[model samples]
Target: MPVYLDHNATAPVRPEAVRAMTDALNHVGNASSVHRFGRDARRRVEDARETVAALIGVQPGDLVFTSGGTEANNTALRGHGRTRTLVSAGEHEAVLQARPDAETVPLRSDGTVDLDALDVALAADDRPALVSVMLANNETGAINPVQQVVEIARRHGARVHCDAVQAPGKIAVDARALGVDLITVSSHKLGGPQGAGALAVLDGQSVAPLLAGGGQERKQRAGTENVPAIAGFGAAAEAALADLVRMTECAAWRDRLEAEARALCPRLQVHGAGAARLPNTSCLGLPGVRAETQVMALDLAGVAVSSGSACSSGKVHASHVLRAMGVSEDDADSAVRVSLGWTSTADDIDVFLDAWGKLVRRHGLAADAA
Candidate 1:
């Protein structure tokens, strides 16, 4: 059996979610209709909304379901009508490309956003501004200090938006505690179906709809609700909440993987090692081997991994996240991300280590010893 270690890209669907989706798929109704069938479908959607909302500590009424994380991010970043936007250099392309004109806040060497730079940038302009920062980075798994970011943005009257898609199942994500005005989350990241996601608006923050249509999602988002996917999302949220302890336990395996890899190649670079990171993620770099080469080798060895975010149409390029943290171009090109999840086991780590050890012995040691 192949060992899957790329949970940060997407996790295998949980049994609970599959059951819920299957049940909902058998139903036939439009949630917008007034008939009994419609009411039942609406109930499922609302129940999902409540569950998803609880996962992030937001009001059930505060969420507007979208197609997925990318749409949720675009809605939050673009719907606010802010003339000026500031996003961390390490953000996903959804946020970066949402407003190509947005100013970039540099990151510290540890891969967390630089709060000082954010403060200075927010103070630079008097125009209405939106500050977009992620709770946990997808590639390096570095957890940003979002509470401090909110405190800084509030001083300049800038609304804070957090792309929290990577944080729910792996870490505690409380939008209220973080004090972000808007937050984005995805279903597949938490073992749900991929087509569902949510944008939570907090403290009476109003966001204009990206899609204009009938009175759905309280007119915040317009379209017929995707009932089966929403049901699966809710079921997945509940299951993920219950599995938090197991997720945290994966940290030991992740640490061992990094430690063992370092033993094989002392020059190995673990990006974001100096910062608070998600428990299951390790961005490892073998200086002499290119990332694509490592990924391909590991795939052939029956251990799956990724060079970086899977968003980029199956291409392996130098990680922009590493580059933002001031990693050298050569090192950036050599890095691959290994993320664990609830389905991961100790044997998975062992298989990865075995494959990685051979890879280092074959391709890395000679270059390092030179």
Candidate 2:
């Protein structure tokens, strides 16, 4: 089997999630119905909510399920009645596109948001404003200084929203500790099924519905719940919660891949190396090779990796994240992202290193053995 090194893209669904979803599929009742079947279905949905909410450290009543992170982000951005929005340069497209007119905060060369720049942006505007910063970047896996962002925004009287879609199972993401008003999380990001995610709100904070249906999701969101997907999400959250204590162990795997690759190509540039990053992610630049070329070559070599965000549809564009961090377009295009996951193993790393070594040699950039 091909070594899949792109956990940041989407992880393979966990067996636990699959079983939960399949069992949910066998159920017969609209979660909105008032009968016994309906009540049972409702119980499952609520249980799932409680499970997921606990995993992210939010109150069950404060969470609202959405189709995915995109809708959750959109609800937070647009639902608040045209409030000014300021987002980091490295935020996912979900938040960036949620408000095109939203002001863009600059990033340091290492890809973390520039807090001083954020303070300036907030000061630049006097209107009721919202600040959207991510907990962890999807592309470079760089962890943002969200607590600092919160302090700055709070002093300036701005509401803070953190898109922590990539953070739940991989690190500690406490909503109360971070003290943000809103958080976005994705199920598939860890091991849950796709098509289901949530927007977590601080108590008393409200968001407008993107799709107003039949008063589902406590009227915070509408439409009947996708019980199967939601149940799967809950299962994934349970598993991820159990694994958090050991999540840092994955860093050794990421470090191994990075060190070996750099050893093979001494000039390699690992994006976000200058900042705090997730333990499972490494964004490596092969200098002269286009990211698309590297991705395609790696795929052919029985390894799967990506250029930047997996949010795109079959297109390999130069990374806007890297560009925002002041990397030249040439360097941005030459980088590829490799992310490890719960199932990643040493064998997987070996397969990746062999493939990457071949690519380095093919590009005439192989490192000299000392």
Model 2 stretches with alpha carbons more than 4 Å out: none
In model 1, which regions exceed 4 Å deviation? Answer: 364-370
Candidate 2: C-alpha RMSD after superposition: 1.2
Model 2, global lDDT: 0.90
- Reference-based TM-score of each model: 0.98, 0.98
Residue pairs with colliding backbones in model 1 are: none
**Candidate 1 lDDT tens digits, 62-181:** 999999999999999889888899999999999999999899999999999999999998887989899999999999999999999999999999999999999999998889999999
Residue 346's lDDT within candidate 2 is 85
Each prediction's total of clashing residue pairs, residues at least 3 apart in sequence or on different chains, is: 0, 0
Best by lDDT: 1
lDDT of 2 by residue, 292-358 (tens): 9999999999999998788888889899999998999999999999998988888999999998899
RMSD of each: 1.3, 1.2
